[model samples]
Target: MCQKNCRGDCDCESQPMGGGQRGTKCDVRILLVGEPGVGKTSLILSLVGEEFPEDVPPRAEEITIPADVTPEKVPTHIVDFSNQEQSAEELSEEILKSNVICIVYSVVDDDTIDRITDYWLPLIRRVLGEEHSTPVVLVGNKVDLVEYSSLELILPIMNQNQEVETCVECSAKTLKNISELFYYAQKAVLHPTGPLYVPHERELTDKCKQALTRVFRICDFNNDGALNDFELDRFQQKCFNTPLEPQALQDLKALVSRQLPEGVREKEGDPKQGGLTLAGFLFLHKLFIQRGRHETTWTILRKFGYDDSLYLSREYLFPKIRVPAGTTTELTEKGHNFLKMLFEKHDLDKDEALCPNELEQLFSVCPVVPWGPELIYTVATNERRFLTKSGYLAMWTLTAALDVTKVMEYFAYLGFMSVTNAESQLDAVTVTRDKQLDLQLKQTMRNVFHCRIIGPQGAGKTSFLQGFLGRTAQETDEIPRAHLPRYTISSVPVYSQEKFLVLHEIDIFSMHDVLTPPELHCDVVCLLYDASNSKSFEYIARIYKKYFEKSRVPVLVVASKCDRSPVKQDYSVQPEEFCNLHKLPPPQMFTTTPATAGEPAKVSRDIYIRLATMAAYPNLKRLVHVLQSRPSWIGEYTNQMMELPPEVTAWMKVGLGAAAVTVMGLLLMRTLKNANTAN
Candidate 1:
């Protein structure tokens, strides 16, 4: 029966109307279109019943089943046109009557897949007209026979060729991914969000652009340039099959209002409250696509009261604070109790202080803010070695309120009196601390250097570290397992010149771990790889690209376990070649074995000393100061300037006395000679 005005010549509108209308029982008409022998019948039978037909007759059939399996409990109409012969006109009429279309191809035969673009897609497009907006799903059957990777190559082509919302691969025989495929198709029809438009790669095609334009024109009744709230609701229902919620409509309004120009709101017909212009409509679509519709930008928008949920709950907005039983006698006491709770939660080991790891966990749980190890060490810990409970409380209170002086006084009353000391006394303490730090800095500069060694599992990283520490492979008890990170400080000087603290760990793979503060500040980074295993080298390369490429610190690459293979294998990449491929410097190569005992140790020591020296005196200014301030240089300069030889002094005195006597004699002689000459 036709629900609207329909001509009897075409049966495109023959299906019952309002079957899937919102807030009622959903009845979807799904059309199955594909090349011959693509298992369309088997897929349909699998979806509707348990048995696969041993023999499928060449016929056209319709199976109407109540599908209580879905979350919505909607009935689905499955039309199988597997072997039916029809003219182009008949096919076009059938296509128009469908709610969703699934185009299937056999994965085993690449030719069948090619015909999807060459034949099936073009016919559908020609019949439905260029501006039609029905959703399409591309299905790859017989996935069990072909490698999944083989099917991946042609998926993008299908997506580009048609209004393909999603592509899925399933085996009707094994029933793999069949249910998921149908669910996606149902979603595409009911909640028809338009095709995603990624900025560079996935863009809206001409067809999509035209469809959207037509949609906008249809919604803009009276041919107005904009759409009001009523118009928008109508548009949402007609285009997406689902009406916008009241909150959703308001959010759309708010978004449009914020985007308008300042004076435009005060114009004669202020568009802010009047309607959304065509330009505004396009802009919102682009924004929703570019920033993902949900995770990041949408989440932020909801927090600002743009969505149904007014804002993030208090737990998500603020850190958890628990009040102690008797600590709420006063308001200040209550606040202090809250602070104590926060510190206790973060101090997982219950040590009353936060280690580097514990502090990182705390920062992650707190409301979104700028965080890093340097900030925690400087502001929260007041440049101290660790953050205590009192320090955490003080930092939070100062930031929470506008009156910092009053907060400091309150803290002083709570036994943090040093915080309220006189400015002069504070200055003295600061100067003394600075001087002490300077001395310690000089000592560290002369004594120790830090290196962080990182690599993949079984890359011989731990073995290399053990060798450097003068431990044999047989002494397994002494070596820590590679799965866990280890920290070791060498008391003895490496290369008999520089001491080193080595932090050995695997590469960080998760986002949570990456946000945390590192336990130590390293002067140099050492990347290790096993020469026998090519995969280890590849892992190191990926690590460098992901993490180390942006770093300004010096990175030293080490090729370990060279002794495992006497001759270079074809699979193994030479250290120089690997470095060249990555545009990095050539690495230091070493072999740690019983036969080559003490050789790797010496080489490791040399590498450490060279890296540390470069890190410590990276520029000429600091190097010059260190040299000029050396005790030996000062003593040598003082002795050279203040001391004189006795023989040279005696010679100087004799020469001066003789010069005076000679002058007197010469004057007397000159006078006698002058008088005689004058006479």
Candidate 2:
């Protein structure tokens, strides 16, 4: 029944083929096995070279085909055992060494395909052991002999067994789908979706154990050997980008409890002692990996109280309020009392008001109400001075009566949520203790433009920083002599707003282990060279080519000590020529001198200004926001309220009623406006 197009000899003699660069090579071993006369040798030859031999003789040797998918060529070794008279022990050893197993069966022989499930699969399972994770592909050779529909019948049965990764039908003689069969074989080995073995209660692999240990260490931030509720929430946010909801958190705790040993579970009965131990963490992750269920991990995270939205309901924040089933006035009174209690908790000094810092701390702990400082100032402040209990009550009531969108608009007006606002607020705060200003500046200026200064030793790089800081070149105390990099911070005005300019100065000669990828997350790079030393300029070029040639960040070239350069024999190239040669913009030429010497000789502030202007402000601003607004203990108490029973609490009913009224009022207003326009 062979097709008319079927041509080419089956050359059974083992022929070696090679291509690609010579070096350390990655080897992918493929073992092609089947019943006798399954054309396993023909498939390998067709894939190795699209040439189909007129007659492929039975071969016992291995065929090595070089695959040049990347810079490093991957050599694929295919061994055919169809015609080899090897013993079962020798065949098992061969199968054990393969990365991928290809089970081939001829289309013409229906019994050969049936024998695959009954004989070959069980043999592979016995040889590989149940634990080894090797990829297997079922390939049906000589597709031209029958219609594809006949082959389709067996495909589903093979897929349902889940023993093989995929099934592909091809004609070895016609060279049809031969290449695709090998490509899939390589893919199966390179990118497997899940682990091979499903472990029982007591079984786990070393690699799985190592992965669990790493995750446990990352989650256990304080080295406490266990993850508390807060730590678990933090881990969820880091991994899943959202904290678990209230019920999900409890479910995860229960799941961990079941996985723990009898002694561990007994001790976990106490609420305070209820957290995951190293064993429990490892066991839970192993279960998830074995089941191949990512949703289970996400479910556990959500239950830990990770939420995408920032806002929460008022009732969720304050559960103690008892709304009288009487009138709106009584409801307002109960809400006022709740606010009074909340304000007193935050007003640590009992001064009848909260400061900006205290207010920030209060919001950090409470469910986010979206009540910005401006609205709080208008409602909570008495005589525009302090946020009193009455102010807090009014603000809460007003927010409850409005829609979430309107509440957000009011919150946005406060402006303290931004890096610039936070910086300005910190600057305005009175420093009560010595060195507090330095700490405040460091904490507030989180969004900074990192400028790395690189130059040869004694190239006046340190002197340039000192000059930029309004110090003189002769300020010996300010100049650092350490071989390590020196860091300095300066507040520079950018776009009419202040931004921190952090400079890191590295000694070019001693930068072997210092130039890490993380250290290079800079906004600007400054290459400094002494005008009198030509070698300094050459070193700068080398550094530039090594690190900054493909960098997206701006690079500034500064030629220092222009005043000290020899007019006759200076080896430094002209700024124009250097710029043209390096394909860089024009360089800034400057000279630094002692403060007492002259005002005109100092380094210019314009250079720092230019660096700041070139910074990616939008990205830096977003980074600052993320760093500042990471999940905190603020609003964590809302989780406690969510655990309460579904019965409508008086406070919750009141809040819901208020929200419904607000929505109805907005709808009524829109309807009236529409009617008036129609009239």
Candidate 3:
């Protein structure tokens, strides 16, 4: 594909295709269409020979211009159309395939020039459709035969048709404007004026404005609504591969200011806060198009990942990714770091959570905020129901695991690649190894774990899931619980790394209700019950005996609403005894009540961490069995040590430290008293 026949390496792997990383046209096809006797053949020959040809064929063989010879570093194909040799069907096929068509007419022949509008233009349109985007370049050949310029007659035709990009008058005999003619043809394909500008309006098109606006915001690193000298220089270097000199930068500022006074502003206290405002940025690009330099604007647009249609390319938003079954998607360390930076920067109130206003500001770069009101109840938030830092990361983590493609798209909309200087959002995401492989290795490196909470009615399961986000029962009750989300995800630190635990509240109306296989399929199971309800324990006890009798999936019995008075179960074996017999951990007590306002909530993380830890380490039951096989005294001591809640251990340390200090104080007092007696 890279030879004379090709004239280009468009099929090369490095070249970006449509909507890819660097948006660009790979090759240009220039097809010359005209009446039989126009100098269409002569123009092609003159461009190759640099001289008028004495003999012209009915049609010239198709020519391929090498990329090095073209002005735009793009290979070009030039084809000549003949009415005698090519049928109308063949001409239409060429019109469909060509990027730009050159309609050649004779400068001295009135009839031939008239046929341009009456015949060629309509012909091309009929083939490509009336609203086709393929550009048309009008060429007037045999200019030496006319003493006067023919542009006067061609001017009205151009004004009347939006498809005509430009008209060039040249003499194929004298080679006058011969090279200029084909250069315009190449320009028609490379940087057409229709999409970027409107000649009559003398302004950038609305679509062009939007694409540039996105580029400007991405370059505005400080979110100051302006591009300072540093940002401007970076933008220049990024798009053009060259930075501007100091004087050039000043000249640009002056140019925008001269055109529109408000285009550039001065911030009194902060010079960096003021540079090229959004208005100025738009004005500069508009000015470039007005001056016939739309290629410059197109360059900036493509560099920032906009295709010809002014939409982000697929390759830019959803880079190549594969997640095999039983595998999961997760954010990489860089992704986590970028999100942390965004949270810290946007938390203007510094309450460690984003209020609605702050959340809007953070997503201002995106076209629309992707997450909606349901996000409030799906993740952990502060007392005001605003998303907290952990909640923010948890939302992202949950998205990455569930719909990773959307994560990539939002990353693109959020300017992840631009801000991180990465090639793609792939650096921010990763596909974890399959769970089957993880099980074989007896260890998993996944940062997300799922726990399905199955409990009878009135077991406080709804409140339990909400508590994962630190929401109290009262807070949950503040609003109608009609469609309250059943899933609540929040970050739980397991030893060293932060892991996201997704609590799915499974509604079980009765103890004997059937549990489906998919319902039981999870990393861990939570048998939640109300500590105040005597019969709550029995519902889960029968559930455990029926469904998860000998399954490898770890199960934890959680006694929720522990803030209420304790009650005994009316089952064959009580909760603690049942756990011991099954080699499972003892029933854990949980409550979000104490977390309400002035109450201690140190133990709130205990149950969540245990659930997540069990999910992470599914072989914990085997470890318990090994411990039970050891000496009874050793087993008892190990169980006691492991079962102690972190809050209890902290209080034990505090009491012991206080006792030691009191003994030292007594010694100090005795020494003082003895010294005083001696005196």
Q: What does each candidate score in C-alpha RMSD?
A: 28.4, 26.5, 10.1
Q: TM-score of model 2 relative to the true fold?
A: 0.29
Best by lDDT: 3
Show where candidate 1 strays beyond 4 Å.
Answer: 1-26, 84-89, 195-679
Tens-digit lDDT string for candidate 3 (1-679): 5311223445644544232322256678899988878889998998889898899888989998898987787778899999889988998889888989999998888898899889989988898899998889999988788788889899889878888988899988899998788788888877787888766677778888888888887787766677998888888887787888879988999999998888897779976566999999999988887777777887777766776667776667778898876777899999999888778767887899999999998887678987877788988777778898888998998888778999899898877776787888999999988776776676898889989998989898888887777667777776466558877898887777878898888877886888886677678899988889888888888888898987768898888888889888878888899999986777877876454477655336667877888788776543432322334654565567567898986786677568757865775566445434433
Global fold similarity of model 1 (TM-score) = 0.30
The parts of candidate 3 lying over 4 Å away from their true place are 1-24, 269-273, 344-352, 436-444, 456-458, 480-483, 509-521, 530-547, 561-574, 594-603, 622-679
Model 2 agreement with the true structure over 113-188: per-residue lDDT tens digits? 7888789888888987865567788888988887754457566555445547667888888888887888767655
How do the residues 210-271 of candidate 1 rate in per-residue lDDT, one tens digit apiece?
A: 33443344345534457776677766654354687978876776786687532112225644
Cα deviation of 348 in candidate 1 (Å)?
48
Ranking by lDDT: 3, 2, 1
lDDT at position 231, candidate 1: 73
What's the true lDDT of residue 583 in model 1?
Answer: 46
- lDDT for each candidate structure: 0.52, 0.55, 0.80
Once model 2 is optimally superposed onto the true structure by TM-score, how far is the C-alpha of residue 625 displaced, in angstroms? 43
Model 3 error, position 587 (Å): 2.4
- Candidate 1, residue 661: the lDDT equals 72
